[model samples]
Target: MPRSLAGFTGAGYDKGRPLLVQALWLTVSTVILGRWWCPNSVRVAMLRAFGAQIGPGVLVRHGVRIHWPWKLSIGADSWVGEDVWILNLEPVNIGANTCISQGVLLCTGSHDRRSPTFEFDNAPITVGSSVWIAARATVLRGVTIGDDATVGATALVTRDVLPGAVVLAPPSADMTSPTN
Candidate 1:
């Protein structure tokens, strides 16, 4: 499948259109697939049936939650790390040869709590080529990391990053220092 929706969000190119790239078409095949991870060909096909646009040489390891299959794109030879939550509620682009490390949360949508209706918001995420998003990094919506950038582990990215840059999200100030 090209995309799926899970964590409080939704993503895609419009609806009911032929995908430009064929990604996971080779991973598996099925009719009306369901929530799955690291499955065989038929299992992968199930995602395709759900409108996911997977690429060649991509390895989606076990237990990765891909939300919004239709709005997601993984370039060739990209490895989506294990247990990664891809919030494709908006568009998420992963360049070729990139490694999205384990437990990374790519969140592209959120609710507007301040608004009276509490409606959902959308934003697209862009990852450049040859980049390595370290484990447990949260790539929030509307972020664009240029080519060759490195996102450190456990980083919470809320802004755009320049190409070839090494970024580290500072720890939240909420944490209090331990004292004797």
Candidate 2:
């Protein structure tokens, strides 16, 4: 069957909150957390107010976009860097001392290719303690990074990373000048 986006309906997907609450979240997020100078305390407080389970000392930087704070749980002392987008249609659990570096995208939603209407295929993302996901990395749905694992910059992680494993981005063309 041919793919038909028009037939697509976001069925079986729970937004986890009412429309009013979502709107309010957007307003607050845009007003405060969106500002570059907004302190991490205020950000944590705001997230907590919205039912997020954010542990103490967790630093959520400015420009970090969380689709649903209620579905987010960050352990103690975790650092979410600037411009990190957590598109958590499902729950995202981040353990203690984890560092989600700048410009990273933790995406929990994807489309089912087999479905003609392209139904949603969502899953949670889990990051274990002491994990380091470097800048510009993309963690797709259903991924789990074990403790002490380091995801290199710009890497696309689509599978589970074992404990203490280091996932690096593939090398591109060499930067050295041609030999004379």
Candidate 3:
């Protein structure tokens, strides 16, 4: 339910929460109803239809948001785990057979703190094939992980990682640069 803010209702966000059984049923039922319902498969299909460029048998679990479907691409046999948040304000590319763990936030947007006016920024996040992004990892914009790279749980990614490398450090935040 949306929160009542003065005379307006506000949208709620709980990206880390799993859908309860009743909530799951409600979500599936919406699929039968119409476009208002965002079933798991339906949402995936919608992403594909919007030119997400997904390969075969990709499963995007609930609570993942792809901001620009047209600019996002996922390779074959990838599993996007539960509550993984993707902000594709910029183009995002994921390689084949990759696993994106739960509660991972791939954010492509940021705000400039140096500027007097708060300006927004964004970048693409690219993950190579067979990579495992563990739970709660935050991949910032414009960072590319090479094939088979493992980003540990709760890790913050800031730079381009070499193939098969791993990092568990706080990410860098720069609001001036943005991705194409």
Candidate 4:
């Protein structure tokens, strides 16, 4: 059957907060947490104020975009790099000592292509302790990255990664070109 885009409302997806609170969070994140000059402490504090469960010594760099603070939980001593986007429509749990590099996208939301309504197929993302998701990598919904695993730059992670594993980005066409 062909896809239908009409009446594609995201039914049954919970926002996890009231409209007023969500609006307040949007305003605060844009004005303060998303700025390059915002202090890490202040940003963390703002996230906590918005209901995020951030642990001690967690470093959330500037320019980071968190869609819903209440759905996020970063363990102690973890580092969230600059410009990282956590689209956590569902819960996103990052374990302790993890490093999410710059521009990484930890997405917990996706659409059901099989459904004509294109309904939400969202699920939580779990990053085990000591994991490192490199720059610009996209971790899709329902992925559970194991402890000590390393996801290389620009990698697209759609499945679970075992502990101590390293998932590198596939070689680009330019990299395979014949050199003189």
**Model 2 alpha-carbon miss at residue 172, Å:** 0.9
TM-score of 4: 0.96
Please list the C-alpha lDDT of all candidates, in the order they appear.
Answer: 0.72, 0.96, 0.74, 0.96
TM-score of each: 0.72, 0.96, 0.70, 0.96
Residue 78, candidate 1: Cα error in Å is 0.4
Clashes of 3: 0
Position 93, candidate 4: lDDT: 98
Candidate 2 global Cα RMSD: 1.5
How many backbone collisions does model 2 have? 0
Tens-place lDDT digits, model 4, residues 11-63: 99999999999999999999878888888999999999999999999999989
Can you list the residue pairs that collide in candidate 3?
none
Q: Is candidate 1 or candidate 4 better by TM-score?
A: 4
Say what the RMSD of model 1 is: 8.0
Candidate 4, residue 121: the lDDT equals 96
lDDT of 2 by residue, 116-135 (tens): 99999999999999999999
Q: Least accurate stretch of 10 residues (summed lDDT) in model 1?
A: 26-35
Q: How many clashes in each candidate?
A: 25, 0, 0, 0
- Runs in model 4 deviating more than 4 A are none
**Stretches of model 2 off by over 4 angstroms after superposition:** 175-180
Of candidate 4, the 10-residue stretch with the lowest lDDT total is 1-10
For model 2 the TM-score comes to 0.96
Instruction: Supply candidate 1's per-residue lDDT for 58.
Output: 74
